[model samples]
Target: MKRRSLIAAAIAAPAALAAPRVARAQAQHNWKLVTSVPRGLPGPGVSALRWAERITQMSGGEIRVQVFGAGELVAPFGTQEAVESGTAEAYHGSGSWFSGRDIAHSFFTAAPFGLTFDEMHAWMYYGGGQELLNEFTNDRNLQIFIGGGSGVQTAGWFKNEVKSLDDLKGVNFRAAGLYGEVLRKVGVNPVSIPPGEIFAALQSGTLDGAEWVGPANDLAFGFENVAGYMYAPSPVEIYGGIEFGINLDAWQALTDAQRTMVEAVSEAEANRSSADTFHANLQAYEKLNAAPDLVIDTFPDDVWQALKDASREVIDEVKDTSDFHRRFVEAYYAYARKSTEYKRYYDTPFLVERESFFS
Candidate 1:
């Protein structure tokens, strides 16, 4: 009986190995995607994994991707460089990670006075934002796609009331990219620390406030437990949208079929992440408000105006240095201004009245 079983197993092995060429090709073409987010088993970490799964399946398992998060394969801050150098083939993370490349990359994550999730998508998909973004990367041999967009964000969690413009003086805040520069202009001491460190910074008195993503993320990081004041209308970012970018060399090597699959999945998942975050924020608002000692607040008129002006100054500083930046921003604001005009006339009545909403 043992000899008969061994003979049958030997016979079955050949059947399983019928496709030798396909197996060899698949083994040779596996790729990797680096992410700054650390949690990898599921949820957000699974994003890169999902992209991997779809690409592999679509390419008949010839295109496998290994998703490594945060420090699994490289240091958190070094992902962009790693991908650019082909030390890793790709990266699935925030656009703000590459702010050093150009400040406009940070706009995809958060910009002072940016748009809502749906609005940005409309702008990106139909209003020509994606094409303009391509133009930004055209010279650098880089390609980016919106991996996710966290909708309208909360202003921030704070230890004290920010009732007037003067309150920001010397405030030690954790922020990033040009927003940091803009905040600096207002006399706030803006600092960049990894996202993993924000909760501890807030708890240990190392930070006066923080403008990390929004409600879904704020609650995820347990901000509701520490910061007593919750500010709204997160003008610096009505959205916290994350972008996934890859080195152009890797992208060019992909077969046309493989490229299409990656683009479609990344674009679709971006919409999913944005809408999911939008829903999560609404639910988190209730949870945040329910906690003890938590006060919901808003910046006064003068404070808002000062923030706007400071943000404008930062923009003026960067505009001419890169024509792509100048042209892209002009196109976006043209649509934005048009949207504002329409919203003012049509939606303000059912929405917040402009006098109350703006002033």
Candidate 2:
């Protein structure tokens, strides 16, 4: 009897070893993704749609996403709330839009005199910035993933060129987040308006000037028709990037592979969107530069100086807000300091040399 049992166990072990392995079945997820911009609008708008597409495609039907443009499902600024309340599974937009809830959110999106695209991307992905974000968003029941960016936005579209620092005083301008605060410090009355209404506002003289994304988007909206001057080097928005805020409960439900797919797709889209914006901006800029009526220029030196001073004051005030703000500010500047050191030696010199060589 013992011999027979041993022989049977040996046969079963051989059979098990020879059997083919089966892959684990992944659960299907259907999500609604809301955006803060109109559907198909260039830059962040189109990038949001593409982000949804890539996730759906890469998942091989395991994860499906449906996207809703701003106001289609919820108001543009309601994106974070929608995801937090589980009204939507995810949201795509700038985190700075919701900075009123926590000033720390601005660093993840746009901060006055903030890091550049490469610097911001590195800070988030490798410099422990995302961990800080996780700490902030966990309380709101949200998770963040950096998705896309607008690289170096235009200064603004002005009805007339700002000739002096005094010109900005009492001017009603459309700006957002920390940008608005900095402008207010410089004596400009900043107004927060939705993107859809900006053109109408500019046309009707409600806004003396407005800062939108950059050349690609500004030209698309036909700001040149109402605003004669388009300025460069938006001080507050060196690199404004978009983020994906997912419902924490929904995120937790995702399989490990599915979660990884979401992150991988987001990183890929972030780099792609930045590159796409730069290319589109260059092409659109060339066209706008040739326009007979539009004038493209930079802010006068005095105005730039005033803006820089105001930016410093605003950022300093934010540091005194709370311990969280202090920590976030410190972390941001630490990385900025390290990054600047490298840029000075390599990027700045190379850029200057290239310009000199070309000219």
Candidate 3:
């Protein structure tokens, strides 16, 4: 009887040990990811689709993310609310879309005459930008990640050239984030329009001008078909970034291995998306320049100076809103000031010299 009992106990122990392995192999996570751009568009749109694929590949089929373009599952501007409300598991979008919630949110996406792509990355990853962002999002039970960015954007597309500061007055323009606020101070009427609607608005004359993204995206949407002039030097959105916000509860549910995979993948997408947009813009610019009817022009010196002054005033106005906003602006400008010196000496000089060759 003792021998028989020993044999049964040994068999039961092995079976119990094997059960956990079997369950782990079968584990799967199906998540829904929504973006601010429509599916299949370049830039953030392509980045969103590729990011979802990377997550699936890295997880070895243990995780699968379903991608939805803007307004597919939720309105483009409603992405954050969807994630927070548990209607969606994750959101791939721009933080500036929610600037209404907190004007400081614009710092995460872009700022007028603010950080470049590399500078913003340095600040977010090394200089405590992410911590401040976390402090803001954590209060609302969400976690944020930098998903993608376009390094720089064109000023906008306009029906007529802007030759002086007076040209801006009373013009109905579509600008995003604090850019709109800066325009407001300068006597321009700035409205916030979604990406898909800008073309229609421009065609119908509802908008006198609109700042979308850079060459690749703007060209892709055929803004040239409606607007005759392409303006240069984006004072706002020097580096336009897209963000990924995940539900805190959903994030906490990930296993240590799964979480590690997510972190690594997010970093990869951030770099890849920015690089992709940069190259695509370069190619698109070549095509745009060849078009005879499209005239590319720069904002005149006086107009640029006026914009610079107004941008400062707009930023200063945020200081009186809250102590938290005050700290955020202070830190952002501190970093921008330090980075500008390096850029002026290095990047600015090289680009100026290089331009002479082409000219």
Write model 2 residue lDDT over 193-212, tens digit each, in one string: 97889999999999999998
**Model 3 off-target regions past 4 Å?**
1-27, 357-359
Tens digit of per-residue lDDT, candidate 3, span 19-138: 344555676778899887779676787788887898888777777889998889998789999998888888988888888988887877768889888888899878888777876776
TM-score order of candidates, top first: 3, 2, 1
TM-score, model 3 to reference:
0.89
Query: What digit string (tens of lDDT, one per residue) describes model 1 on residues 22-72?
Result: 444544356778888874633357666777777778667667778887898
lDDT of 2 at 85: 99
Candidate 1 at residue 32, lDDT? 79
Please report the TM-score between candidate 2 and the true structure.
0.89
| Residue ranges of candidate 2 with Cα displaced over 4 Å | 1-23
Model 3 scores what on Cα lDDT? Answer: 0.83
lDDT of 2 at 103: 84
Give each model's whole-structure lDDT: 0.74, 0.83, 0.83
TM-score of each: 0.84, 0.89, 0.89
Worst 10 residues of 3 by lDDT: 10-19
